[model samples]
Target: MIAPARIRIFVDFWNFSLSLRREDDAFMLDWKPVAGVMVAEASQLLGAPVIYEAMHVYGSYDPAKPADGKFRNWFTTWLDKLPGVHTVMLERQKKRNHITCPQCHGEVKDCPHCHADLRGTEEKGIDTRMATDLVSLAWSNAYDVAIIVSSDRDFVPVADFLQSKGIKVIHAAFPPAGSQLSQRCWGNFNVINLMDKFRR
Candidate 1:
Protein backbone atom coordinates (compact mmCIF):
# COMPACT_ATOMS: atom_id res chain seq x y z
CA MET A 1 0.00 0.00 0.00
CA ILE A 2 1.20 3.49 -0.77
CA ALA A 3 1.90 5.72 2.22
CA PRO A 4 -0.40 8.64 2.81
CA ALA A 5 0.87 12.09 1.91
CA ARG A 6 2.11 14.15 4.88
CA ILE A 7 0.59 17.62 4.93
CA ARG A 8 1.83 20.63 6.85
CA ILE A 9 0.28 24.10 7.23
CA PHE A 10 2.07 27.43 7.61
CA VAL A 11 0.14 30.55 8.62
CA ASP A 12 1.32 34.13 8.58
CA PHE A 13 -0.56 35.13 11.72
CA TRP A 14 -1.15 38.86 11.19
CA ASN A 15 -1.76 38.48 7.48
CA PHE A 16 -4.26 35.66 7.88
CA SER A 17 -5.84 37.08 10.98
CA LEU A 18 -6.45 40.48 9.46
CA SER A 19 -7.93 38.99 6.34
CA LEU A 20 -10.46 37.03 8.36
CA ARG A 21 -11.80 40.09 10.07
CA ARG A 22 -15.19 41.18 8.79
CA GLU A 23 -16.22 44.75 8.09
CA ASP A 24 -17.52 45.10 11.63
CA ASP A 25 -14.04 44.44 13.06
CA ALA A 26 -14.87 41.10 14.64
CA PHE A 27 -11.99 38.65 14.35
CA MET A 28 -12.32 35.10 15.57
CA LEU A 29 -11.14 31.81 14.13
CA ASP A 30 -11.62 28.29 15.37
CA TRP A 31 -8.41 26.66 14.18
CA LYS A 32 -9.09 23.03 15.15
CA PRO A 33 -12.00 22.73 12.75
CA VAL A 34 -10.15 24.76 10.16
CA ALA A 35 -7.26 22.32 10.28
CA GLY A 36 -9.57 19.39 9.76
CA VAL A 37 -11.18 21.04 6.74
CA MET A 38 -7.80 21.94 5.23
CA VAL A 39 -6.51 18.39 5.57
CA ALA A 40 -9.64 16.97 3.99
CA GLU A 41 -9.51 19.43 1.13
CA ALA A 42 -5.83 18.74 0.53
CA SER A 43 -6.44 15.01 0.50
CA GLN A 44 -9.06 15.45 -2.18
CA LEU A 45 -6.80 17.71 -4.23
CA LEU A 46 -3.92 15.28 -4.02
CA GLY A 47 -6.21 12.33 -4.94
CA ALA A 48 -4.73 10.42 -2.03
CA PRO A 49 -5.16 10.00 1.65
CA VAL A 50 -3.17 12.52 3.66
CA ILE A 51 -1.99 12.82 7.23
CA TYR A 52 -1.93 16.09 9.16
CA GLU A 53 1.71 16.44 10.16
CA ALA A 54 1.76 19.88 11.72
CA MET A 55 0.49 23.48 11.69
CA HIS A 56 2.76 26.44 12.32
CA VAL A 57 1.85 30.11 12.92
CA TYR A 58 4.52 32.82 12.66
CA GLY A 59 4.13 36.28 14.22
CA SER A 60 6.01 39.03 16.06
CA TYR A 61 5.39 40.87 19.31
CA ASP A 62 6.99 43.69 21.19
CA PRO A 63 8.28 42.64 24.60
CA ALA A 64 8.90 46.17 25.80
CA LYS A 65 5.18 46.99 25.79
CA PRO A 66 3.46 45.49 28.80
CA ALA A 67 0.01 45.18 27.26
CA ASP A 68 1.30 43.71 24.03
CA GLY A 69 3.62 41.27 25.80
CA LYS A 70 0.85 40.10 28.10
CA PHE A 71 -1.52 39.57 25.22
CA ARG A 72 1.10 37.63 23.28
CA ASN A 73 1.72 35.35 26.25
CA TRP A 74 -1.97 34.63 26.63
CA PHE A 75 -2.54 34.09 22.94
CA THR A 76 0.56 31.91 22.52
CA THR A 77 -0.46 29.78 25.50
CA TRP A 78 -3.87 29.16 23.95
CA LEU A 79 -2.39 28.35 20.56
CA ASP A 80 0.22 25.95 21.98
CA LYS A 81 -2.49 23.81 23.53
CA LEU A 82 -4.07 23.05 20.17
CA PRO A 83 -3.19 19.69 18.66
CA GLY A 84 -0.30 19.64 16.19
CA VAL A 85 -0.15 23.44 16.33
CA HIS A 86 2.99 25.47 17.04
CA THR A 87 3.45 29.21 17.40
CA VAL A 88 6.68 31.00 16.58
CA MET A 89 7.11 34.52 17.92
CA LEU A 90 9.75 37.01 16.84
CA GLU A 91 10.66 40.28 18.48
CA ARG A 92 9.16 43.32 16.71
CA GLN A 93 11.98 45.64 15.81
CA LYS A 94 11.42 49.33 16.37
CA LYS A 95 12.49 52.05 13.98
CA ARG A 96 12.06 55.77 14.29
CA ASN A 97 11.13 57.61 11.12
CA HIS A 98 9.46 60.91 10.45
CA ILE A 99 6.01 60.88 8.98
CA THR A 100 5.60 63.22 6.04
CA CYS A 101 2.45 64.65 4.58
CA PRO A 102 1.62 62.93 1.35
CA GLN A 103 0.42 66.13 -0.28
CA CYS A 104 3.23 68.51 0.73
CA HIS A 105 6.01 66.03 1.54
CA GLY A 106 6.76 67.93 4.73
CA GLU A 107 7.52 66.25 8.04
CA VAL A 108 4.51 65.95 10.30
CA LYS A 109 5.92 66.16 13.77
CA ASP A 110 2.70 66.09 15.79
CA CYS A 111 -0.42 64.02 15.81
CA PRO A 112 -3.36 66.06 14.53
CA HIS A 113 -5.67 64.96 17.32
CA CYS A 114 -3.46 64.31 20.34
CA HIS A 115 -0.50 66.58 19.56
CA ALA A 116 2.08 63.81 20.12
CA ASP A 117 5.12 62.93 18.01
CA LEU A 118 3.90 61.14 14.91
CA ARG A 119 6.71 58.63 14.64
CA GLY A 120 5.54 55.58 12.75
CA THR A 121 6.32 52.09 13.97
CA GLU A 122 6.57 49.19 11.62
CA GLU A 123 6.73 45.45 12.32
CA LYS A 124 9.68 43.71 10.69
CA GLY A 125 11.16 40.18 10.33
CA ILE A 126 7.84 38.30 10.40
CA ASP A 127 7.74 37.79 6.63
CA THR A 128 11.40 36.78 6.41
CA ARG A 129 10.98 34.33 9.28
CA MET A 130 7.96 32.76 7.65
CA ALA A 131 9.71 32.44 4.29
CA THR A 132 12.75 30.85 5.93
CA ASP A 133 10.60 28.30 7.73
CA LEU A 134 8.73 27.40 4.57
CA VAL A 135 11.92 26.86 2.57
CA SER A 136 13.69 25.07 5.42
CA LEU A 137 10.80 22.66 5.85
CA ALA A 138 10.78 21.86 2.16
CA TRP A 139 14.53 21.21 2.16
CA SER A 140 14.18 18.93 5.18
CA ASN A 141 11.49 16.86 3.48
CA ALA A 142 9.10 17.69 6.24
CA TYR A 143 5.94 17.03 4.26
CA ASP A 144 4.67 15.97 0.85
CA VAL A 145 2.34 18.97 0.63
CA ALA A 146 2.50 22.40 2.27
CA ILE A 147 -0.65 24.52 2.69
CA ILE A 148 0.26 28.16 3.10
CA VAL A 149 -2.24 30.70 4.47
CA SER A 150 -0.71 33.99 3.49
CA SER A 151 -1.47 36.72 0.94
CA ASP A 152 2.01 38.22 0.82
CA ARG A 153 3.77 37.95 -2.53
CA ASP A 154 7.06 37.53 -0.72
CA PHE A 155 6.31 33.81 -0.59
CA VAL A 156 5.90 33.42 -4.35
CA PRO A 157 9.50 32.35 -4.82
CA VAL A 158 9.25 29.80 -2.06
CA ALA A 159 6.21 28.27 -3.69
CA ASP A 160 7.98 28.09 -7.04
CA PHE A 161 11.04 26.49 -5.49
CA LEU A 162 9.01 23.90 -3.62
CA GLN A 163 7.06 22.95 -6.72
CA SER A 164 10.32 22.61 -8.65
CA LYS A 165 11.37 19.97 -6.11
CA GLY A 166 8.18 17.98 -6.84
CA ILE A 167 6.44 18.99 -3.61
CA LYS A 168 2.94 20.33 -3.99
CA VAL A 169 2.28 23.83 -2.61
CA ILE A 170 -1.28 24.95 -1.98
CA HIS A 171 -2.38 28.47 -1.22
CA ALA A 172 -5.36 28.91 1.10
CA ALA A 173 -6.59 32.47 0.66
CA PHE A 174 -9.78 34.50 0.78
CA PRO A 175 -11.81 35.26 -2.29
CA PRO A 176 -11.90 38.37 -4.56
CA ALA A 177 -8.44 39.46 -3.37
CA GLY A 178 -6.36 36.35 -3.85
CA SER A 179 -2.59 36.74 -3.76
CA GLN A 180 0.34 36.26 -6.04
CA LEU A 181 1.30 33.36 -3.82
CA SER A 182 -1.88 31.66 -4.90
CA GLN A 183 -1.06 31.96 -8.58
CA ARG A 184 2.39 30.51 -7.98
CA CYS A 185 1.23 27.49 -6.03
CA TRP A 186 0.19 24.10 -7.39
CA GLY A 187 -3.39 24.74 -6.23
CA ASN A 188 -5.42 27.61 -4.81
CA PHE A 189 -8.18 27.07 -2.26
CA ASN A 190 -10.32 29.93 -1.05
CA VAL A 191 -10.83 30.06 2.69
CA ILE A 192 -13.84 32.31 2.29
CA ASN A 193 -15.89 29.43 0.94
CA LEU A 194 -15.04 27.35 3.99
CA MET A 195 -15.61 30.12 6.48
CA ASP A 196 -19.02 28.80 7.46
CA LYS A 197 -17.56 25.43 8.41
CA PHE A 198 -14.60 26.70 10.42
CA ARG A 199 -15.11 30.31 11.36
CA ARG A 200 -16.48 31.33 14.73
Candidate 2:
Protein backbone atom coordinates (compact mmCIF):
# COMPACT_ATOMS: atom_id res chain seq x y z
CA MET A 1 0.00 0.00 0.00
CA ILE A 2 1.25 3.49 -0.77
CA ALA A 3 1.48 6.00 2.09
CA PRO A 4 -0.50 9.23 1.82
CA ALA A 5 1.28 12.30 0.45
CA ARG A 6 2.80 14.70 2.96
CA ILE A 7 2.71 18.51 3.03
CA ARG A 8 3.74 21.25 5.46
CA ILE A 9 2.78 24.93 5.69
CA PHE A 10 3.96 27.77 7.90
CA VAL A 11 2.40 31.24 8.33
CA ASP A 12 3.74 34.41 9.89
CA PHE A 13 1.22 35.32 12.57
CA TRP A 14 2.30 38.91 12.93
CA ASN A 15 2.38 39.62 9.20
CA PHE A 16 -1.38 39.08 8.91
CA SER A 17 -1.75 42.56 10.34
CA LEU A 18 -0.48 44.23 7.19
CA SER A 19 -4.20 44.31 6.51
CA LEU A 20 -5.82 43.84 9.94
CA ARG A 21 -5.58 45.94 13.08
CA ARG A 22 -5.47 45.43 16.86
CA GLU A 23 -6.80 47.71 19.57
CA ASP A 24 -5.74 46.06 22.80
CA ASP A 25 -3.68 43.20 24.15
CA ALA A 26 -6.82 41.16 24.89
CA PHE A 27 -7.69 40.43 21.26
CA MET A 28 -4.16 40.82 19.97
CA LEU A 29 -2.78 38.04 22.17
CA ASP A 30 -5.68 35.72 21.44
CA TRP A 31 -4.55 34.91 17.89
CA LYS A 32 -4.85 31.17 18.25
CA PRO A 33 -8.35 31.54 16.88
CA VAL A 34 -6.99 32.97 13.67
CA ALA A 35 -4.34 30.30 13.37
CA GLY A 36 -6.87 27.57 13.99
CA VAL A 37 -8.98 28.94 11.17
CA MET A 38 -6.06 28.78 8.76
CA VAL A 39 -5.14 25.31 9.89
CA ALA A 40 -8.66 24.07 9.23
CA GLU A 41 -8.67 25.56 5.72
CA ALA A 42 -5.28 24.05 4.91
CA SER A 43 -6.23 20.64 6.29
CA GLN A 44 -9.25 20.51 4.02
CA LEU A 45 -7.06 21.04 0.95
CA LEU A 46 -3.89 19.09 1.80
CA GLY A 47 -5.52 15.75 2.79
CA ALA A 48 -2.63 15.08 5.13
CA PRO A 49 -1.43 15.90 8.62
CA VAL A 50 -0.27 19.48 9.17
CA ILE A 51 1.58 21.38 11.86
CA TYR A 52 1.70 25.10 12.52
CA GLU A 53 4.26 27.17 14.37
CA ALA A 54 3.69 30.62 15.79
CA MET A 55 5.35 33.29 13.64
CA HIS A 56 8.10 35.59 14.86
CA VAL A 57 7.59 39.36 15.04
CA TYR A 58 10.05 42.10 14.16
CA GLY A 59 8.47 45.52 13.79
CA SER A 60 10.14 48.70 12.52
CA TYR A 61 9.04 52.20 13.49
CA ASP A 62 9.68 55.63 12.06
CA PRO A 63 12.30 56.04 14.88
CA ALA A 64 11.97 59.77 14.64
CA LYS A 65 9.20 59.46 17.25
CA PRO A 66 10.90 59.21 20.64
CA ALA A 67 8.05 57.68 22.65
CA ASP A 68 6.81 61.14 23.32
CA GLY A 69 3.06 61.54 24.10
CA LYS A 70 2.32 63.13 20.74
CA PHE A 71 4.37 60.55 18.92
CA ARG A 72 2.72 57.73 20.90
CA ASN A 73 -0.74 58.97 19.97
CA TRP A 74 0.05 59.05 16.28
CA PHE A 75 1.76 55.66 16.24
CA THR A 76 -0.94 53.95 18.27
CA THR A 77 -3.81 55.35 16.21
CA TRP A 78 -2.23 54.31 12.94
CA LEU A 79 -1.40 50.87 14.23
CA ASP A 80 -4.84 50.35 15.69
CA LYS A 81 -6.41 51.30 12.39
CA LEU A 82 -4.22 49.03 10.28
CA PRO A 83 -5.02 45.63 11.81
CA GLY A 84 -8.56 46.95 11.80
CA VAL A 85 -9.54 45.63 15.19
CA HIS A 86 -13.11 45.63 16.54
CA THR A 87 -14.80 49.02 16.74
CA VAL A 88 -15.05 48.99 20.52
CA MET A 89 -11.36 48.37 21.10
CA LEU A 90 -10.44 50.47 18.10
CA GLU A 91 -12.27 53.45 19.52
CA ARG A 92 -10.73 52.85 22.92
CA GLN A 93 -7.17 52.75 21.64
CA LYS A 94 -7.67 55.62 19.25
CA LYS A 95 -8.72 57.77 22.15
CA ARG A 96 -6.16 56.47 24.60
CA ASN A 97 -3.14 54.43 23.51
CA HIS A 98 -0.45 53.88 26.07
CA ILE A 99 2.38 51.36 26.02
CA THR A 100 5.44 50.99 28.21
CA CYS A 101 8.57 49.04 27.30
CA PRO A 102 10.76 48.46 30.28
CA GLN A 103 13.61 45.94 30.22
CA CYS A 104 11.28 43.49 31.99
CA HIS A 105 9.90 40.72 29.80
CA GLY A 106 6.48 39.55 31.12
CA GLU A 107 5.42 42.33 33.41
CA VAL A 108 2.73 44.38 31.75
CA LYS A 109 3.67 47.97 32.19
CA ASP A 110 0.80 50.46 32.31
CA CYS A 111 2.51 52.21 29.45
CA PRO A 112 3.49 49.64 26.81
CA HIS A 113 6.29 50.27 24.37
CA CYS A 114 8.03 48.11 21.78
CA HIS A 115 11.80 48.07 21.59
CA ALA A 116 13.24 46.02 18.76
CA ASP A 117 16.70 44.65 19.61
CA LEU A 118 17.41 44.07 15.91
CA ARG A 119 19.06 40.64 16.46
CA GLY A 120 18.08 37.00 16.15
CA THR A 121 16.52 35.57 12.98
CA GLU A 122 13.15 37.33 13.37
CA GLU A 123 14.89 40.51 14.42
CA LYS A 124 16.74 40.36 11.13
CA GLY A 125 13.35 40.56 9.45
CA ILE A 126 9.83 39.19 9.99
CA ASP A 127 9.53 37.82 6.45
CA THR A 128 12.90 36.17 6.78
CA ARG A 129 11.82 34.71 10.10
CA MET A 130 8.63 33.28 8.61
CA ALA A 131 10.53 31.87 5.64
CA THR A 132 13.08 30.34 7.94
CA ASP A 133 10.27 28.71 9.91
CA LEU A 134 8.71 27.41 6.71
CA VAL A 135 12.00 25.98 5.52
CA SER A 136 12.68 24.45 8.91
CA LEU A 137 9.31 22.71 8.84
CA ALA A 138 9.76 21.60 5.23
CA TRP A 139 13.23 20.09 5.61
CA SER A 140 12.67 18.37 8.94
CA ASN A 141 9.39 16.80 7.86
CA ALA A 142 8.34 14.84 4.79
CA TYR A 143 6.50 17.58 2.95
CA ASP A 144 5.83 17.55 -0.77
CA VAL A 145 5.18 21.29 -0.81
CA ALA A 146 5.19 24.32 1.45
CA ILE A 147 2.63 27.11 1.22
CA ILE A 148 3.47 30.62 2.38
CA VAL A 149 1.78 34.05 2.35
CA SER A 150 4.17 36.93 2.43
CA SER A 151 5.71 39.65 0.20
CA ASP A 152 8.77 40.65 2.16
CA ARG A 153 12.21 40.44 0.58
CA ASP A 154 13.87 38.54 3.43
CA PHE A 155 12.05 35.38 2.31
CA VAL A 156 13.98 35.26 -0.96
CA PRO A 157 16.74 33.19 0.57
CA VAL A 158 14.27 30.78 2.12
CA ALA A 159 12.51 30.30 -1.21
CA ASP A 160 15.78 29.67 -3.04
CA PHE A 161 16.89 27.19 -0.43
CA LEU A 162 13.55 25.37 -0.38
CA GLN A 163 13.58 25.06 -4.17
CA SER A 164 17.07 23.64 -3.99
CA LYS A 165 15.61 20.92 -1.78
CA GLY A 166 13.06 20.08 -4.46
CA ILE A 167 10.19 21.20 -2.26
CA LYS A 168 7.38 23.18 -3.87
CA VAL A 169 6.93 26.65 -2.40
CA ILE A 170 3.55 28.26 -3.01
CA HIS A 171 2.85 31.93 -2.35
CA ALA A 172 -0.40 33.15 -0.78
CA ALA A 173 0.45 36.78 -1.58
CA PHE A 174 -2.67 38.83 -2.45
CA PRO A 175 -3.35 41.65 -4.93
CA PRO A 176 -1.75 45.10 -5.54
CA ALA A 177 1.56 43.26 -5.04
CA GLY A 178 2.22 39.58 -5.56
CA SER A 179 4.99 37.75 -3.76
CA GLN A 180 7.34 40.69 -3.49
CA LEU A 181 9.51 38.27 -1.59
CA SER A 182 11.45 37.93 -4.83
CA GLN A 183 11.42 36.36 -8.27
CA ARG A 184 12.03 33.01 -6.67
CA CYS A 185 8.87 32.78 -4.53
CA TRP A 186 6.71 34.85 -6.90
CA GLY A 187 7.41 32.41 -9.69
CA ASN A 188 5.50 29.86 -7.62
CA PHE A 189 2.97 32.39 -6.40
CA ASN A 190 -0.66 31.31 -5.94
CA VAL A 191 -2.75 34.21 -4.74
CA ILE A 192 -5.74 33.39 -2.57
CA ASN A 193 -8.84 35.55 -2.94
CA LEU A 194 -8.73 37.95 -0.01
CA MET A 195 -12.46 38.59 -0.15
CA ASP A 196 -13.13 34.92 0.50
CA LYS A 197 -10.35 34.65 3.04
CA PHE A 198 -11.41 37.66 5.12
CA ARG A 199 -14.46 38.62 7.19
CA ARG A 200 -16.87 41.26 5.93
Most TM-score-accurate candidate? 1
Clashing residue pairs in all predictions, respectively, total 0, 11
* Model 2 CA deviation exceeding 4 Å by range: 1-4, 20-125, 186-192, 197-200
TM-scores, all models, native as reference? 0.89, 0.44
- What pairs collide in candidate 1? none
Ten-residue region with minimum lDDT total, candidate 2: 86-95
lDDT at 27, model 1: 50
lDDT of model 2, residue 17: 52
lDDT of 2 by residue, 56-119 (tens): 2234333333554454454346433433221111111121223334664443333325654322
- For model 1, the local distance difference test gives 0.82
In order, the Cα lDDT scores of the candidates are: 0.82, 0.46
